[model samples]
Target chain A: MIPTPDLSHLKASDYETVYEPAEDTFILLDALESDSDTLKQLRPRLCLEIGSGSGCVSTFLGSILGSSEALFLCTDINPHACSCSVATGLQNKIPLNLVNASLADPLLWRLQNAVDIIIFNPPYVPTVADEAWTAQADRGIGGAWAGGKDGMEITNVFLPHVSALLAPGGHFYLVAVTQNNIVAMQQRMKDIYGLESQVVLRRRAGGEHLSVIRFSKTLAVKTAVFHSNTSNNEVL
Target chain B: MVRLITHNLLACHAKGCTSNNFPLQFKDVQIVVRESEFNPDFLRGFIPKIEWPALVSSSRELGDTSLSDQLPEMLDDAFLKTLHRVLFEIHVEEGVMICPNCSHHYPISNGIPNMASSVTLLIRGLPYLASSWLNMKLANDLKIS
Candidate 1:
């Protein structure tokens, strides 16, 4: 007996469609909750999501956090997302602060290490120009898949920011496809910042399985490693 | 935990501040390497939202410069492993994010960016107070009007 979600469609820059979530959004939200619970061993206190296609993810998150004494902020680079989030919040009886902003902007947001969890379902498959690139699918320019060439460009931009929003011990869940060069991406994540991350879930379809990645950040605040010689990369 | 995402959102716009005061640059950065299993799918999906050159150069600046100039020709495990580490595993625990043009420095204390300097704080808070004061002034103006 799920409550009806407020539905609305927020349009994106071009060729990108923002669907205000109704039903399908529930399953995705369920997936995120299920995955997030596994990581924290309980429902978290704070949750933030980006690229929320419709208000579904936003709705789900709001409800989950609202049930707890928590806060939820749903942001999308698309204008449509901003509107949909508002409506969805009202429909679901959950409170949400909607932000219509892209990932490229410097986050002036005040939430610092306050988020206990972060979730994203990014566009993974590269658009071949011939492939159907919808507003829903084309999360970015060079291709519908946000990260260019290797589907990590966007993730790279996002990873460090994830740390800022998370608390001392926080979790991040990201979903993607196998087409993005995985090996190199993993290595880059490892060699660059020394944060640990792994894929916790996978589903196969037509030789492709949707993959879910769950990552956690350690206390990276500078004072944690003041004695280290080079402050730039302690433990390097 | 200053996220590159957060970094992209900040600009040093103190009073009369202008110039390329954006994309707060990283400095005195610290990188940590922790290994987590790889997920090719996640990496693939995340490609759409990235600032490619910023990521490439930032990684290089932080000293995890293994990512080649181009995407890997193949999805070989060895190659993906490296990419995975660089893209996800590394962490910047401490540093200052400085504005390239305005020389505005956003300090990253404890992996969290102090997006505010005292100047920014006073500047931002003052306006709210000013507005409230202005409203009071407006009430007085009403008497005159």
Candidate 2:
């Protein structure tokens, strides 16, 4: 069991501005740890994490990879989060490149089909649409949650860019709640982008049913089909 | 903060600022070279994915000329070491990244780049917010009547 990245450098004041790692973050870590072998086999060169609130997730990924080979790029709307992320990376001996931008707005064209791994733990709380917009505009701790209209207003905007950004064999892991209509989302990604998905890990945290869904190109999984089919022929 | 590896992936995203947006021009930059663990295998595997010309030019912009103008046919340790220094060792502690196309400046201070166009976006969103608030008020008034 790889220990969680040490965030001893951060203070209570830091949590006021940045998100403190919680159940959702832990579940994402568990999912990645479970898939560590596959990830290491991929030998990813570039990994991006959108909304790296406390920088815990990306730092954890660096630990899992256990090498400095891959470039870990993290983005957040909050400037404070960006600073905290950089500090966390330094604390954990992970080299993280931080961009204080909303989503992947500045990276899309240059990184087209080149990102090997993409992780996003978006704001998945059901709030009024305006609240989400305001949170995003404010670019503060509220932006970490306050997802508008079934907690998908922010996630929906980012979904269309996933296929465009992922490398041929790239994997995108997303955190979503039951209210986000996970089934429909999976179907939409498969239908629109030709990406296949699997529910990697799920847990009931408080009143929220949080799950991590891993999406990859349909063609990229052909090699793994034989192994997967041994357990469930329909998976292919 | 900026590194050549991250800089190699940045392009301008200002509204309608598309062509020639990449390889953001650095201005008034302060650079620091911090030693990092070097792995030759990682550099070798990553060479194919790099935009050679951009990396070379960006390195030159920051006053480093270790890399040749073009990618070398050889994959020797000496070359990989140079590539590692250019890609990972050098860090931009402070700078303004100017978009070649739009001339929008993204400032990097204390090792974090502020790339959000929040002020303009919020200004643009105000009218929509006001209209929605008005509609809600009108609906509530009708219910009262």
Poorly placed runs, candidate 1 (over 4 Å): A1-16, A19-30, A36-45, A104-109, A128-147, A205-208, A219-236, B1-145
Report the lDDT of model 2 for residue A147: 81
What is the number of residue pairs that collide in model 1? 87
Predicted chain A of model 2: TM-score relative to the true chain A? 0.92
For the second chain of model 2, what is the TM-score against the true structure's chain B? 0.87
Cα displacement (angstroms), candidate 1, residue A221, comes to 6.2
lDDT score at residue A210, model 1, on the 0-100 scale: 65
Model 1 agreement with the true structure over A1-236: per-residue lDDT tens digits: 33445453334432344543432244355556666445335445556777665556756655554432344555565554555555566566665544434431233233455566777766555542222122223333322243333444445446555555555567767776677665555566556644467876566655555667666767554212111111211111
Superposition error at A180 for model 2 (Å): 0.6
* Residues B13-74 of candidate 2: C-alpha lDDT, one tens digit per residue: 87767678888999999999998889898888778768889899889999999999889999
The residue pairs in collision within model 2 are B1-B111, B1-B112
